[model samples]
Target: MRIVDTHLHLIYPDRFSYPWLATKPRLNWQPWTHEAYFAEAVPLGIETALHMEVDVAEADIMGETEFVLGLPRIAGAIAACRPEHMNFVDQIEQLSEHAHVKGVRRILHESPDDLSQSDLFIENIRHLPDYDLSFDLCLRDDQLYLGVALAQRAPDVTFILDHCGNPIPNGSGLDPWRASITEIAHNPNVVGKISGLVNHCDPGWTAETLRPYVEHMIEAFGWDRVLWGSDHPVATVTGGTLTDWVKATREIVSGASPDEQARLFHRNAERIYKI
Candidate 1:
């Protein structure tokens, strides 16, 4: 089956400034160029990819999008944005003008809880539907309720929940994560992205180790509301390779019918991201 990787991050330190990489030594080794990514991705059936923003410095956000959209097999981009800023409308205006810029993301996992909950933040997020842009919610497992609140307020906008709500595969946080995901999925406008599980797992993680989380996500959101994502270099740095993640994801969901698999692998991505 052809795969549409909805969360590929291509880094270039020479051309961009990623201050966050300083705290993540593993991912800061060198630039994770598109050439290095596609060498392995193409063989694994990833025919197209959406370049997810790498949280580069504000000055380089648009630059990163422009550069990656020019790379081979990169179907579109999920550029970064700061909804709290007064210039957010300008940012979305510029991004929406680009045909290949499918959506925008603000890394809320490490950010303060109140950051996205503010009135101004919610107001800016509400503006997405005007440009026909979706928002990728990169929230931690515990922060999922905030996602629920954001999704509810912006019923007109489509929200892609990244990393299956970013739960830990170790099972300790399973109960609450499941509860939160279930609540979030109740919103018809929200979709789940099956990516980044490897980043939250230990080195010895296997397909079986990831099964529960993946299955629950699909169960909650149903097949049509879920899509596939590689989470790429971050997955590699954290625990596994893009190849391992693809294999494991397929293995876990193998019981589903071909149509169901197609939706998760590529079909839903095409509909959700409009690539």
Candidate 2:
């Protein structure tokens, strides 16, 4: 059960500035270094990982990428980018110079709805293919349609839907989330990441609570289009452990064929991120 974690975030307050963590007291209280992560991860069959960007300050973006790629088992990094800016091409050009930069992500989950809907943002996203980069879409449950719209406009670029569209598994948003996921998968350009749900779940959530959401995503995107991620310290923010997530995922997909399991756990991530 080897895993390729596609959404692991490492925090380094000394090296970079993560202003958003100010509001997230739990995560901000300590740095989540690779050494701390791999101690638990290695035992659970996580071999390698891609360091997802933590939305560091604009000044520390490239520096963060360079720093993480040097860590052990970090196959690559998903660096942060500002597609809304006019100089986005220049930014990607700089990011493209580093072979470890597998893709780029602009945190759309917390930003204003129109942040990524602007003409400039769409135009900038269209340029990703030029640098051989993918985009990780981190939208909230309500903002799932925005992901579909962006995928439609940038058919050439690969879109990895983070957190199974970051669904709110509170029972009410299920049907609409399922519809949006199906629509997103229809584009052929978007893939789904099975991570981040623990943060959205209630304290009492279990594999059964997450079964429907996970099943719908796999059904819509198919095994080949979906991959697993730890979401690490963030996963721990909601009283969920990395080990618990891995074990729960293993339980939920226990009936799938080994080949199908391989695709979801590691194969798709290796191919999609070029890891």
lDDT of 2 by residue, 46-111 (tens): 999999999999999989999999999999999999999999999999999999899999999999
lDDT of 1 at 74: 90
For model 1, the superposed segments whose C-alpha errors exceed 4 Å read none
The TM-score that candidate 2 achieves is 0.98
What's each prediction's clash count?
0, 0
Clashes of 1: 0
In candidate 2, list every pair of residues with a backbone clash: none
Model 1 — TM-score against the truth? 0.98
Residue pairs whose backbone atoms clash in candidate 1: none
- Worst ten-residue run, lDDT, model 2? 167-176
Q: Each candidate: RMSD to true structure?
A: 0.9, 1.0
How would you encode candidate 1's per-residue C-alpha lDDT over 1-275 as one tens digit per residue? 89999999888988999999999999998889889899999999999899999999999988888888888889999999999998899999999888999999999999999999998999998999899899999999988999999998888989999999889876555888999999999999999999999888879789998899899999999999999999989998666888899999999999999999999999999998998
